[model samples]
Structures are given as C-alpha cells and as structure tokens.
Target chain A: MRRRSVVVVGAGPAGLAAADTALAAGADVTLVDSAERPGGQYHRMLPDAYGARAPEAVQHGYRSFERRVRRVLDHPRCSWWAGAEVWALERRDPGGAAPAAPAPSCPPPKVHVLAPAPGGGPRRRHVLEPDALVLATGAHDRVLPFPGWDLPGVCTAGAAQALAKGERVVVGDRVVVAGTGPFLLPVAVSLLEAGSTVVEVVEAGARARVARGWLGRPWELGAQAGKAGELLALTGVLARHRVPYRFGRAVVAARGDGRVEEVVTAAVRADWSVVPGTERAAAVDVVCVGHGFTPRLELPVAAGCALRPGPRGTSEVYVDVDDDQATSSPGVYACGEITGVAGAPAARTEGALAGWLAAGGAPRAGAVRALRRRRDQGRAFARRLAHAHPVGAAWPGWLRPDTVVCRCEETDYATVCAAAQDPTATEARAAKLATRAGLGPCQGRVCGPTIAELRHRHGTGQPPAGPTDPGSHHRPLAQPIRLGELARPPAPPAPDRPDLAHLPPEESGS
Target chain B: MSPRLVPARDDSVRRTDHPLTVTVDGEPVPGIAGQTLAGVLLAAGRTAWRTAGSGAPRGVFCGIGVCFDCLVTVNGERDVRACTRRAHDGDAVTTQSRRSGDPGDARAGERP
Candidate 1:
C-alpha cells in the first residue's frame, strides 16, 4: 500500500506533533513554517548563531520540545521547509467535472507556497496537493485601540516578548506592560529578563471578578496544575524585580512628542468602564498592551472550514472540528489556537490526534482516546480562561473620537463611528467600504473583530450574516504575494512523490 | 531612552560577536548576527523608522509580521517587514514614509 501524504501548514507545537505522529504512522510528511526555525511563536527558538549555553532557562518544556524537533525533522519521511509561507489554498471543485481517480470525495486544497531561495535570491513558488492537510497557524496578540496607541514606542505585548525571547533585545529602557490575561505576567518577566525596567504590570480585570473566574471551579483545574505553577513562578519573578502588579487598572492612553514618553493609567470597573477621577500618569519609554489573542484564521477560512462561535460571551470564532479532529472540509484538520486559544499542551494533543487520523491511523486506537480527553480538558480550560479575562463589553468607551482604530489605514474612531451610525451605511460591508478600515495592508487581521463589534454596537441594527459580515474574516489571498510572483505559474506537481527532492532547488533543501 | 541588548553575562544567553553592518539611509548601522533589522534599529536608539499617511512616526507595533507598521525598503525591495527580516551584512535599508506628497509613499508610483 502507498503511504499517505500529509502536509502540515505550521511548524509550531501542534503542527510538529502532527508531523511526528503522522510519520510514526508510516505517512510521508512535509512540515512548513514561516520562521527560520521549527518552533512557532510558543517555542520561538533563539537563532543558532546566539550559541546560548542555557537556552532552556528562557523556555518552558524545552527538553520535550527539543526531543520532538529532532524526532520530526530528522525522520527520513519528514521534509522540513523553513522560511516558507503558504500564500494560498486552492480548493478543488466538488463537482465531478474532471474526474481524478483515487482522489477523496472532498479533496484537500492545493497548497501554494512561496519558499525563500537559498543564498538570499528571489523567492520561488511551489504548489502541492497532499492527501491530507493540517493547519496550526496559531494566533497573534489582539490589542484594543487607545488614544495614542499608534505612537512609535507603543507595541503589542507579544511583540515585546518575541523580541526578548527570540533576539535578546528589550523594547525599551523603561516600560509598562498592561493587558487582561495571565499572558501579561510572562511578558513582564521576559521584559525584565531582557534588561528592561518594568515599572508596572496593569491588568484590566477587577480583582474580585478575576479571582471568582479562576477559583469558581477547583476540580476542573487539576489537569492544569503545571499552568498554575508557571503563573506562580512568573509572579515570583515580578516580586523579586519589585515590579508593581496592579489589578483593576488599564493603560487607557499614551502620550508623547514623536514617541511615547508617558502612559495614562486608569482604574476600571469589572466591565472595563473607566472610573472617574482614577486616572494616573507614569513616565515610560514604551508601553506594551495586549487584550488577548486573535487566531490566524486566514488559512482555515481559505480551506473552507466551518467556524463556530468561540468561548461563551465572546465574539471570537474558532474552527469547528469533530471528535477525530477533522474539519468540516474533508481531508482537512485544524489544531492549536485556531481551534481555540487553548495553550500549547492542548494544541500538541490535538495535533497528534489529527496527524494520526490524517495518516489513516485506526479510529479506535488506544492513544486516540487519551488524546480526546486531554483536548477536552484544554477546551474546558479555554472556557475558564475566557470567563476570567473577558474583554469588557465597555472597552469601546476607552476610545476617543480621534483615536486611530486601524493602524494601516490610519482610520480613526470618529470616521468609524460616522460610518457605523450613518443610516445609509446599515451593512458592515458598507461601513468598511466607507472607512477603508480593514482594507489596508493587514487585510483586517488586526481590526476585523473590533470593527465588527463596533458596527454591531453603533449601527442601526446587526449586520447581516455571511461573508459580508465584518467579522467574517475571509480573504482570498491569505498571504501577501508580489504581482510578479502572482503572475507566474506555480511549479507543476510532482508525480506520486512526497519527497522534497522532487521540489525545485530553492525548496529541495531539508 | 534606547533599548539595549541583554548582556551575555547577565542572561547566560551568549551571542556570537559576529559583527555586521547594514547601511540605513546611506549611513552604516552596526548589528550582530541573528538580530532582526528591527532589533538592530531599536538597540541603536533609532525608533520610528516609518511614517503614516498623517505623517505620524511609526515603529514596531506587532513585531511578528502580522502588523505591517514596521515595513522598510531593503536592498531596493519595497515594503519588507523589518520585524521579521534578519539584517544581513551590507544590506541597504531605507526608511519609508506614507505621507501623500512624499516620494516614499509605497503606493505613489503604482497609481495616479
């Protein structure tokens, strides 16, 4: 029997696990990631040139991750494509016009990749049609707009942490890390470790609400003891650094001349409505803010995967998957934060299950049962997380009319509000067209959800559902491709070979 | 205040002393291997490399390439993300501006 071929679109924990287990199940695997390394944002490995003696000191579960990296990348059946971006996924027509024998009823989408050429030449594009596809593209920080967020020195907490972890570079000499989740703690620790003087870590969730959200259910957290311990250790580091961790407070505005010189912090109620007379100012070179995470949904949506509403009471949406980790679209599977913002452990378990199933592993395998239970626990934890650090419905109150909502288009709150409130612009699509908020370079990856929510809040009525919905989050071109690259024909698919040796010189490298 | 690199002795993450220079706007800026273009610029105390349509100075916002605010022209290639691209020796980096009348407008030549 021929070996099943699997293409995992992300080299993160979930994608790595998918490749590892698929290879173990005797399937040929091709693992691809945009970064130069195997680890996604979670395991963001420092460049080998750093030659760090204690890389593990800055990472969690580093030893296990290292083992997985070797096991998958070194496996003969696994082809690793680093610094490759999946520009598009071309869905095969479901209609049986051109009959291709042995193709699954729901054929996997054709993968279009832009792989970097060896030795810094122009990137070459390749196309692949695998038997099964696994998506683990992961998520990015979702920052709410504020008065001076577009200032030079303000950045997302994830960006600050990425600089510290991946490059040993701190974002600033003096910084304020403000957000609404446990993720804020680690960002502060990373900043401090990278030699930044973290003046304060401000969390928007009220102390009582946050505690109730976490302590409301004790038994459910038994599987997450490791997570709790990690948070506790992070808090200890903050205490040792003498960094003040303030609850019920948020950085509502940033002020500076050319760059951020000060941040205005204000106390907020449980719903994040600012309390009158509670505003305070602190001088800082940089301010890092993160509300939560927004999943990289372009690939999954491009693959035509169905999305279900995210955790209770949130407008977020995640890929809908079955018990076997199969997406609604056949031959497609989704894991990691794209399914939900469950942490790495859950993503890994989901990946293993998806990989095994995609490789045609037995449905009733003993390992499959264990993986499902862990995935369920992860989902439960995701629910608790959302309950605890919910983005306050009143967060829009933080926005001033002049605040820039869309960084790329430089669309401000007043313009967005005007578009939303205009009687003629009843549809979210109309508002987007009017303001050009999500049409900029980012393609709404940063402001889609926020704009959708703002429209639903300020508009005359709820925007009609479907792709036209501002939050639909659909884009035909998943990644940016230059006109020249797009005009060129994709490399022809190799015949019956899953090995990278068949690929062009640029992508043939392991 | 400028961002600085964490010293090897302080963090136990020893970086190779492989020195490299990338010219920025005709001036040579020094950096080490494994550091991104954004990292070098931040460490060199030069933030706000790009400007918005309103002429507001911008720098790294979302450093992982999701946000295009950190874009710079590299080696004459337009709109390369500074946060994700590793700086190479002799790489020519030019700061970009989106102000309507500025020649640096990324879309200026493409349209009317």
Candidate 2:
C-alpha cells in the first residue's frame, strides 16, 4: 500500500504533535515552519548558534517538548523543513502535478513555500503536495492601540519574552508590563530573570472581575488551582523583586522623545473607560503591552475553510474543525490556535487527533470518545481564560483622534474615524479603501483588531467582521513572497513525480 | 546599561561558542554569532529601526515578524524585517528610511 503524505504548517507543540502522530501512524510527514527551527511559538527554539539564553525562561514542559521534537526529527518517516514560509495553498486541479510522494492517482493540495536566505536575496520556492495538511500557525500578541503605541520603545509582551528566550537580552531598563490575562505574569518574570528592571505589571481588568473569570465552573476550579497558584507565585516574585502589581488599571499612553520614557496609566470602569482622577505616570524605558491574542486565520482562510467566532466571543475569525479535528475542507485539519486560542495542552491534544485522522487511521469509537472528552476540558478552560481577560470594548476611549491605529500605514484615529463615519465606508474593506487603515505591509496584523473595534465602538463604524468577508483578511497569499520568484515562469512539469526523498537539506540560517 | 546585556556566558538555551561583529549603518556592532538581526540591534542599543513621516520612531512591535514594524536595510537590501532574519558575522545593516518603503522609494519592504 502506498503511504500517505502530510505537511504540518507549524512546528510548535500542535504542529509537532501532528507531524509526530502522523509519522507514527505510517504516513510520511514533513513539518514546515517560518522559524529556522521546529517548535512553533510555544516551543519556539532559537537558532542553534545562539547559546546564551536561559531555557528556564520558557519553562513549560521543556523535557516533554525536547522529547517530542526529537520524536519528529528522529522518525524515519518524518522530515523537518525549517525556514520554509508557506505563501499560498493551491488546490490540486484535476490532472495537475501534486507536490509530494503520495497516492499518485489523486493529486493532493500543493503548498508554496518561500525559503528564507541567510543574507536575504533572491530565493527559490519549494512546492509540496501532501495528502493532508495540519495548520498550527500560532497566534501573535493582541495589542490594543493607545496614543503612543506606535512609538519606538513600545513593544508587545511576546516580543519581550522572545528576546529573553531567543537572544538572552531583556528589552528595557525599567519595563512596565501592561495588559490583561495571566500571560503577562510569565512575561514579567522572564524580564526580571533576564535582569531587566521590571518597574511594574499593570492589568486592565480589576481584581474582582479577573477573579470571577478565574473561578469559572465548580469542577474547573480544581483545574484552575494550578494556574491560580502560578499566578499567586508570580505575584510573590514581583514582591521580592519589588515590582508593583496594579489591578483595575491600564496604560493609556506611552510618551517618549526618541524611545519610550514614560507610561501614563489610569484605573478603568467595568466597561474599561478611564477613571477621571486615577491617572499616574511611571518612568520606564520600555512598555510591553498587549490585550491578549488573536488567532492567525490567514492559512485557514486562504485554504477556503469555514470560519467560526473566536474564543471569548471576539469578532476574530478562526477555522472551524469537527470531531476528528478535520477542517471543513477535506484533507485539511487545524489544531492549536488556528482552530482557536487554546493553550499548548489543547493544541497538542487536537494535534494528536488531527495527525491520527489525517494519516487515515480509522477512528476507534472508544479511544475517540476519550480523546474528545479531554479536548473539551482543555477548551472549556481556555474559554474561561478568554472571558476573564476580554479586550475591553471601552479601550478605544483612551485613543485621541490623532492616535495611530495602523502602524504600517500610519493611519490615525482621525482618519479611521472619518472613514468609519462615512456612509460609503460602511464596511471594513470599504473603510480600508477610503483610509488605507488595514492595507499596510503587515496586511493588518498589528491594527486589524483595533480597526474592527474602532469601526464598531464609534457607532457609525460599519462592515461587520465576517469570514472571507471584506472586513477580514481574505488574501490567497497569507505570507509575502518575492514577486520576482513567484512571477518567474513555472518550471516545466515533471511527469510521474511522486519522489521527494532526494531533496536537499533546507537552507539553514548560517 | 549594565554592560549591554550580552548573552550569558553559558546557559541551557542555545548560544554560539564565539561572538561576531555585524555592521549597522557602516558602524561595527558586536553581537553573538547566532543572534537575530533585531537581537543584535537591541543588544547594541539601536532599539528602533525607522522614523515615520510623523517622526515617531518604530522598532520591534510584534517581534515575531508579523507586524512588519521592524523593517530595516540589510547590506544593500532595503526593507527587510529584522525580526525574521538571522545575523551573520559582518552582515551590513542600516536603519530603513521612513520614506524607503513608501511609494517614493522603489526599494521598499518587499516580502520574501
């Protein structure tokens, strides 16, 4: 029997699990990721050459991740392709050449990758045709815009953590970590461990509101105990380090000359509007701010998958998957944040299911039932977390008209507000056309959420967020690829090509 | 700033056995061999990469490269995202001009 071929788009926990499980299930597997190494964002491994950082900074089941990564890399049926940026997914039109060595009779979907170069120049694109693809492309920092958010020294909490983990450098002399959710705690601790002067941690949610969400369901309280202990422990560390933890507050604005010098924060009402007299200033060289996370929908949307409401009822779109972790599109399965912003555990469980199913492993009713139960538990916990730290709708009250909403396009509050208020610009796409808010190089990664909220919070704003809708990103090429390479004439098709074993090693970062 | 936060001498996390110098805007900047170009920039005190038309400086917003706010010039290549590219010894880098990737400069931040 011919073996099935599979490509997992991310190498993080979910992607790695998917690839590993598929390989174990007898399907040949290839793991492709933009990063130079496997371990998507959760287990993001630094380049091998960088040896100065501390592994303890990312102390989330490191031994397990190491073992999992090893399992994928060491498996005879599994291959790892790092530094591969998937640009687009092309459906296998009938009779067209498929990208991998699989059942040759039926062409599978082809994935286009723009391989990264060490010094950055013209690079070759590698094409992969797999019988199944699991997209575990993880989430990025969700930043709610403030007056000086576009300033030089203001960065996301994820960036601060990445620097310490990947480069052994903390981003600030005196950093003020601001945002909602438990994610901020580790970020602050990572900075402190890395020797940064963490002046404070400011949470947007009030203590009472956060605790309500933390308590969640009664049975889940046992599940929440570990996280609660972690959060409590982080607070103790902050006290020892003399870092103040402030609740019911948010960084309304960051001010600086060339780089950030100060963060002005204020207490907020339940709706998140600022309290009148609570404004205060903190002197800091860097401000690490984030609302939470938004699911990365580019890959799934590009693949023409069905979209569902994101975790916590946010307008963010995510790929909809079924019981076996299969996406609406056949042969495509989505795990991890791509399905929704559940943490590593949920993503891993989903990944195992996806890998097994994508490998054509027949579902045994008993095992399937057990796995489904576990998957549900993980998701329920995530929902609680998302609800606890909802991106306050009133957050925009902090923004003045001149504030920049889209950093890539330099679109400001005034311009976006104008577009939102305009009758012709009722939709996000129309507003984008009118003001270029979400049309920058990022294709709206930094500003899309804020733009969507602005179009609504302003009341006059229109164009409800929808899947494959104008308000949301629907671009076929999710990641950017050089025009010169893509525009170059397609190589003549090789006939009867199902052999990929002889491909050269990927172009590694030197 | 506290001896410029070099990668620790030894840690469980990966690092290079030796350090290398990458050039930033014609000036030699010392960095560990395996650090990212953005890491090199942050380690060297060159935090922000470009000044906007509004004169607001922008650096590593979404450090994982999705934001495109960290674009810079590598060697002669214009408008490359520093967050995504790794730094090699003697790699030439420069702060991208605010106007570089706008409609004006033909050499702008192009995705690869």
Give the number of the best model, judged by lDDT: 1
Name the regions of candidate 2 deviating beyond 4 angstroms. A52-58, A93-108, A116-121, A221-229, A311-313, A365-367, A459-470, A488-498, A501-510, B2-7, B10-17, B100-112
Q: CA lDDT of each candidate? A: 0.85, 0.76
Q: What TM-score, computed on C-alpha atoms, does each candidate reach?
A: 0.95, 0.90
lDDT (10s digit) by residue, model 1, range A137-238: 999999999999999999999999899999888899899999888889999998887788999999999887776666666777756656766787888999
Q: B59, model 1: CA deviation in Å?
A: 0.5
Candidate DockQ scores, in order: 0.80, 0.54
Identify the CAPRI category of the predicted complex in candidate 2. Answer: medium
TM-score of chain B of 2: 0.77
RMSD of each: 3.2, 4.8
- Any residue pairs clashing in model 1, and if so which? none
Q: Candidate 2: deviation at residue A169, Å?
A: 1.2
Q: Per-model i-RMS in Å?
A: 1.2, 3.1
